[model samples]
Target: MRYLIYICFLISFTINSQESIDAALINSTDIKIDQIVALDNFETFYYLQDNILYKQNKDGTSINYSNYQLGEMSTANAFNSLKINLFYQDFNLVIILDNRLAEIFKIDFNTAQPYKNVSYVSTGFDNTLWVFNIDFQQLELYDYKTNKTRFSAIPVQSIVLSLESDYNYCWLLTENYLYQYNYFGSMISKIENTGFTQISKSNGHLILKKEDTLYFKHKKKEDILPINLPKLLINQFLLTNETLYIYDLEKLHKYQLKIN
Candidate 1:
């Protein structure tokens, strides 16, 4: 009787542990996408396909915008409803688009002297841009209208992997560390990297992907929880609030996270 009780306890513990870590696959849909830009809401998302930017609404309606001269879009940052910065690394230009998928303006980085080698760009506060100066290995807040750098951080030591920002803060992900900076270009916080390749932020929580595993943590907390994904050949994934969207080249999987 004692042995049976112990066995049952072990099995129950294992089951509970797995349940705590795993994400529940709520639904999945067929999707062909090269990259995902924004999860505007639970049902709507924006993606890139064949050099064209598309906004897929909740009701399966899609509105697309494209600029043939811009070449392929390298990255896009939808900082707010009013501003979306789309960077074309090959063309050395950044195109500003509104929420309705209308092109507002384009900034040719080639004309921005002394900071020509811009590898990445993100939307900053008050019509400014957070750009990674690849030539100088520094992060700069550039004003397109004035054609001047409003603020510049010291050269980073590691190779920058990605850049993200909102109206109040900017986050830089390097090969060695994750850095958070204020709008004034002052480093506010730094977290040591634990072999993460990609990151996404929503509602004060940070989601990181390293290898095939996903991890989640709060902005001010140190505890990291491993989020288990359903078995699939994942190309990339994104987290919006408590929902996780996994893209496997051909289909997009949606999971509802209940990590405790």
Candidate 2:
């Protein structure tokens, strides 16, 4: 009996001494974080408002140039090279913007059904644009070429709430599920967990929030590592390089990670 007690004590000590693991923090020099962009006294009014995409320069002024909610203002490709916007009033309006937030081009939806529902919008690689239509309970992709719209076949049945696209893949979050779709709109994999308030991707990994817990996962991992967070309501999250920017609807916080 005494021997068994001694062995158990040693085991407990070993377990307690083990180090916790987290995502590796890239070097600060290697991971340059831009200054925090603060837009004061701007409240989001529309439940389904267009992207008031603006760029904050080194001086912290966001040069604004949206059509003043003239139409359904959809996706904001702020990080993309072209920074395009998908606008549809009665027809699909693709508005191109420069870095200064100036309007460049406006392409009207020229189809038999000019007034189709654009549920979601995102940018694609090779200067392509992704248009998500939610008509007849289906999601279709429309690739915008230089001056024309080509219908692509990427079907969706779930209700997409927010979406983001990159050169190779796309990340979409519905009411209760999160999906990773390729550029062609084919579902690669999906995770069904509710209360996913916001998501951001960088360096092939994604950072999301479920309730008050912040979770991080790589591209192919099936499980997520929960990060330590206080009891504060988080409305959105943005991950860049290795830093996680948390927006709590009232303030922003920065987190540095250390993987062991």
For all candidates in order, the CA lDDT equals 0.81, 0.57
User: Against the true structure, what is each candidate's TM-score?
Assistant: 0.86, 0.68
Compute the lDDT of residue 134 as modeled in candidate 1.
88
Q: List the residue pairs that clash in candidate 1.
A: none
RMSD of each: 5.5, 8.3
Tens-digit per-residue lDDT, 1-260, candidate 1: 99999999998887555533568888888887789888866466788888888888888888888888767788877746577788899989998989898988889988776546899898788879999998889899999888889898889899898887777888889999888888888998888888987787776677787888888876666666788765678687777878888888988888888755
Best by TM-score: 1
Report model 2's TM-score to 2 decimal places. 0.68
**TM-score (C-alpha) between model 1 and the true structure:** 0.86
